[model samples]
Target: MSTTSTQPANSRSRVITASLVGTTIEFYDFYAYATAAVLVFPVLFFPSSDPTASLLASFAVFGAAMVARPIGAVIFGHFGDKYGRKATLVASLLTMGIATFLIGCLPTINQIGFWAPALLLVLRLAQGFALGGEWSGAALVATENAPAGKRAWYGTFPQLGAPLGFIIANGLFLLINFAMPADDPSQKSDAFLEWGWRVPFWFSAVMVIVGLWVRLKLVESDAFKKAEAKGTIRKLPVLEAFRTYWWQMILGTFLMLATYVLFYLMTNFTLTFGTKPQTLPEGGDPATFVPGQGFAYTDFVIMQIIGVVFFGIFTMVAGPLADRFGRRKTLIWVTSAIVLFGLTFSFFLMPRENPVGEGTYWMTLAFLIIGFTLMGLTFGPMGALLPELFPTNVRYTGSAIAYNVSSILGAALAPIIALALLSTGGGNPWLVGIYLSAMAVLTLIAALLMRETKDSDYTGDAGEASASHPAP
Candidate 1:
């Protein structure tokens, strides 16, 4: 269990691969669902008289998954903290994979009536539940095995999964979109709605198999073994986490708030807004029209993919910066930039005189690149910062709770709120920008309150000192 400087090279490689691949698969499954929520589910599953109503209903199901995440965090965190990371990680990946595959095979509302959306919600919650455990475990696996002075750098490996997954999932959808027979290059073919959209969901099964294989090869980290040897493993880690580290939990949650808000806004809300028509259709009533910067779905997705490349790059860049400058200082600077970025949303996203023209397209693409860049800077450090807040004994529980709890406050509400704000602003994105700015301010406060955790001892456990009895 001891990590020496001369740990086997393959062992280090396996640790990075397992942690990265597991989260890559988990995020792929999640992103597949997210893309469908915007494109297919609103029409196929919700089917309301109003388009906005249908989209809202679809987003509601998406947000419902966030509601289940905290519960998942508690359940998975308990076993992860008590038993070990390996089995719990495998279980979470399997659960997420199965749920996503079944979603691909589901009957649409037209075929199954009310049962369609009902079944979708169940599977969505399962995905959320699985992910609740997946991230924290993966972060632990990477950081716990890190060499001296490189925990932050190692931590970025798992965080890389987000952009990697986004690219793969969205790229697959883009390919499928192009392959389907359609008169217009930008619009979805009827065939896509009926079947093409399901391919990404089913593809998750194959990715999960690879992830499981990698994870099964993992050994418990040195930190976990040390906790076990010292009899620091608790019978009830969740209770102990809340009892001892509640303040850290609160700080960690808010620290993640702006990142979640920005992420969902960039991926989910932007997709919805970008694809909406800039002008009313011929013979349509002006009173009922909602203006948007109408780009074709395919075009906008390509734009998003471009921006996500910056997301991936900055994520890696954040790790080294955090390692050098400290997590708190790096996050404070990045979060402040996010605040300024939020203020510019309207300038970038709003419709121009010619919404779909070449000039507007370039501006929107710039907006996406800048937003995703800031997202990367803020999101990358979380893998190290959150886990560093708690000792090894309760680290899994404490970090998972904070991470997923923030999901409820930020990811769960961001798209729904942004959409409503769009409606409130009459399709101008300024109100949505204000919402993001407000959340970033909260995150800034949390960052200000948090102590620098760059130098925290990863292998120590304060819980052991307080324990009346050790695990036998």
Candidate 2:
């Protein structure tokens, strides 16, 4: 097969569909866990001796997957570079689907003692491992088959999965949370904890069936086929990637800093912050007022669902914009905007004290809209930009390493770090904002350093892949 971007229309559509569906299912699984971590895990899994400690424990389980991502990248990248994108993609989807379904079946701390959290951690790691491999395969297939000026647009199909997954995950969790209500403030809601949370996890088994049906239909990326035909496949892509493309791996990880920081702060940190009882300021009496803003948890989830829908729309818009403005340039602008968003996060929307009026409601909406809009613009181009940094031979290994390592640095620990900061500052959000701003600066510098790869040739091999096969 020719590796030319001008493939048949039917194949192109199938490739794009495969990419979008697989990526969507992967993200949906992830975001669902994140939402649950804030709302359910603390109560169900950890020692409730201290609120902050339990919350930290929940986040640690969440971060466990991030820790596994780079390892998954190495393992899966080898097969993707040697076997084919389609097979690796299918396997990764099954890995995630099965892990998620199992998570639904696990017992809570009350039912199974320590085994509950231990089992949950294992499944979380599996989910992380599968996703580490999943995104790169989807991205590589889409871009490799796309026409020259259209790779960025094609790339967004996979990136678009984040917000689409976010909406579905948040929506389901929201509905589940609503199914059981807290009729008395003195007691917790066991209805949701007992059974409502399990519904989404079991549904993942069905989602896996759909994702596999679509992904299994995908034709291999033309670029990979071209390399295999020319006898240029490598057996040990991981070593080759490190030896030749270490700089790109490093820079790509740094370039993703702002995006990783922004999302965890938005979704995980905010939920924890909003729902945790607000500490009374010095000299204030608790007898006269409610602790925290008293914002409804389900209402906040609804707000997030609406915000994520726009997040998806802007991600779609970013595809065409990147094709026109240049990937590097567009990323630089979007990241710079994120810096401004970080600096103003508290001033414009979140109330420093109890929000007693309608004005605070509008401010809260403003905060989410601005943050997600910027998230959409910046995230859309990443799928195209990361793979473009490497040649076809090491593209899978290189992009996988860079993308997953950044997850460890940013998303993996973001909620934990933000919680510590919040606890230290007595619930002040400024520390978290500062952390987000610093990451945006790193992202800006990285964008400035990277070369524009929108027009790079994907059909060529990198200096004869050693051994016509690297060691497996």
Candidate 3:
């Protein structure tokens, strides 16, 4: 702890808090757009004749940010590795905050037509760019500042942000939705479409203010500082990262794919699938009521919030499990479970072919609990695992690229794919489940190839300093 002049003995806790808070704000901004894509973007931004086409258009623009994430990783990673983690982190937060707040101010299709979606695509890119730099920096700060044998446990704090962000994002959406006339079938939703959805995006400004305050309070992380002191920091971390750890990046990308697939499927895709109005029955019992049709938006949010609670619980459990069982092994088991869960998604998410009314809501909640529990298991160890893949010098660049690459390949396209499959099958969750299972298997293989890294020395000069002081 003596390596720093400004920080006190509680530096580890401070670092964890800062990382968690910052990432929460980042994901909150992210899911806010995701929720809007389904609930409002189709009606507000992409006006279309066919309702399916409109939703798909909203999802395509939603994918734009995922595409931009790797680019953000490059820009932020260069500066983070070149200068310091603290500065880059603060910059990322401000960038996302500004972009998200502006999204609230943008006009809808009624006001601007084509330019509405065009401008939205641009801001979504900014959001992705900012987040590309965020998670890696946050993860590193927590793990680098952790105690000897508690990297996974400390790392969980930053990992904690995903579910926390889900809760906060949906919690706000649910509250705002409650205040509006979204559920009223009497054609009273003009206020909701016109102004209600924007409230969440506009609220991000206040969140960013608080996030920046916590992040600014943080000191530089010990791991990055140690490498810098020894003159081991690389001038070009991107090239060096690929040269030394290219294969690791590929494997890390796949390792994270299952988790990303798991989340986006349940959260984003389900938001769209569960909210549309029902049409002519394709081939079902005429008596069975189809779920997720019109005005079910708030109900789905409530279901997701319940799942978030379970995700939070298992996320805490996952950290300790990873610490004891080893990171690679923990990931492998979780990925396998994800595969099985994906295969069984139809049974869990919908008990009957056409479940109607309150029973359907209970079934949806059950499915979310099952899916999100797996999400937590696969996701919680990542803050420790990704940074362990490369040495301290190129850690930020390596992990950032790998994390966001999975975003592009898996999450960036999930809702679009899910909706496409549903539109083809006349709303079939089984096809979406099969898509998830395929990605999960790929992730399982990547986990198999990776070695346990919990024992690696992360201090300096290719090895840790021998047992200096225990964790704070």
Candidate 4:
């Protein structure tokens, strides 16, 4: 504690706070687009003669970001590993802000025709590129400052940004929905699709400004600084990460699979299902007499907020659990839970109505609780787990690429897959649930197969340090 007093502690706290807040903003910007893709993009950017095709089109563009994420990881990973986490963090945020703001300014399909979607894909790629570097930088800043024994616990703090970012992004969207008039059957939803949909995108500019201010306050990590002092940083970080840490990256990608699916199910698929009249439970009958009647969006928002809180709580719990029981045990249990919950969620909880029926409220609560709880377990330990798997010299690039690459496979396509399955399988949540459950099982198997790295030292030379750290 006394190694570097006054200035160092103050600077570290500033750095951690900035890292957390900046990533939170980045996630929010990225998530805002995700929410729009599920809720409004079909109408705003990809309207088609056929309604189903329009939804599919929106999802295609949504998939575009996921596909671009791996590319972003490679490009950003090179810079992050070669340079330093701080510079990459700043650059990623700046790029994300610009892309998001451009998304806001885009004219609808009506104005720009097919070019609307084409240009939307480009901006989405930019968003993916920026986000690829943000999380690794944030994680490094927080974990590098943590006390040795408490690294896992402190590491969980940066990961909290994911749920927190979702809270902000979805919370804002809910607020806008309440304030706006898109809900009324008598009113023109077109008005919102044309102009109001842009509000969230436009609001991204504030996040960029605030994010830059906070990020600039951060100092480089002690680990990275030391590596620089020794002149040991990798020139080709992406290649190094793949050559040495590919197994960890693959494991992380799989481990993250269930968590990402759960998130998209809650945030995107639920919104799509909830708003669709045909999917509503109880034959499209509005429960106007119910106590919480006429508060459809409100209920979903409340449930998700509760889920986010539990996400934080479980993340806090995961740290100690990982320390006591080990990362493998924790991840295995969490992945199993994801499978079990996915079954219950996809089978019993999904709303059967076109627009979500009132009965769907209970399902929403069930899914929220299950998803958020598992999310806490998996995501909480991952911050420590990923970095611990690699050496400090390539830690940033290695972990960032792994994490974002997983996001591409697990999260980026989740909504599209869910929607596609629904369209093809007559809205059978069972099938979607089954698919998610299988991925969770694979994750559990991956966890079981990995060697435990909980007792490894991360402060030494790459080879010796990693030998001690191992894989699990």
Cα lDDT of model 2 by residue, 1-472, tens digit: 3433446333777878888999999999998788878778888999675555677899999999999999989888989887888799999999999999898898999999999999999999999999999999989978887876888898999998898888888888777766677785322478888878878888888888998999877777657766776666776778888887899999999988899989888788776665555555445444422234445687666767777787888888898899998999999889989888888865754555556356766677677788888888988898899999887777888999999999999999898888776655555577788889999999999999999887777655543645444455
Residue 165's lDDT in candidate 4: 82
Q: Give each model's clash number.
A: 0, 2, 1, 17
**If scored against the real structure, what TM-score would every candidate get?**
0.96, 0.93, 0.91, 0.88
Clashing pairs in 3: 274-292
Candidate 4, residue 322: the lDDT equals 87
Please write out the lDDT profile of model 3 over residues 1-472, one tens digit for every residue.
Answer: 4545223224765887898889899989998998888777877888765656677788888888998999999888888887888899999999999999999999877887788888999999999999999999998888877877788988888888888988888888778767776455422277777788888888889989998988888776666676767666777878777766799899889989988888999888777666655554345343332334443666667878888888988888998899999999999889888889888866755434454467676767788899999988888999899889878777889899999999999998888787666655555678889999999999999988898898987655321221122311
Top candidate by lDDT: 1
Give one digit per residue, the lDDT tens place, for model 1 in 210-250.
99999999888878877788878888998888877899999
Task: Estimate, for each residue in 1-472, the C-alpha lDDT of model 4 and write its tens digit.
Answer: 2355212332546756776788788888888888788678877777755556677788777767777777777777778767877788888889989999999898777887889888999999898888877777777777766666666776787788888888888888777766676566423366666667688888889978987888777766666666666666766767667777788888777767777777777677766665454423443333211111123555556677887888878888898888778888888888888888777755555434333455766666666776788888888888788777777777887787778878877787787788766655555566677778887888888888887878766654444333333332
Task: Flag regions of model 3 displaced more than 4 Å.
Answer: 1-10, 182-188, 281-295, 350-354, 461-472
Model 4 per-residue lDDT at 267? 72
Give the C-alpha lDDT of model 1.
0.91
- Where is model 1 more than 4 Å wrong at Cα? 1-10, 281-289, 468-472
Instruction: State candidate 2's TM-score.
Output: 0.93
C-alpha lDDT of candidate 4 relative to the true structure:
0.73
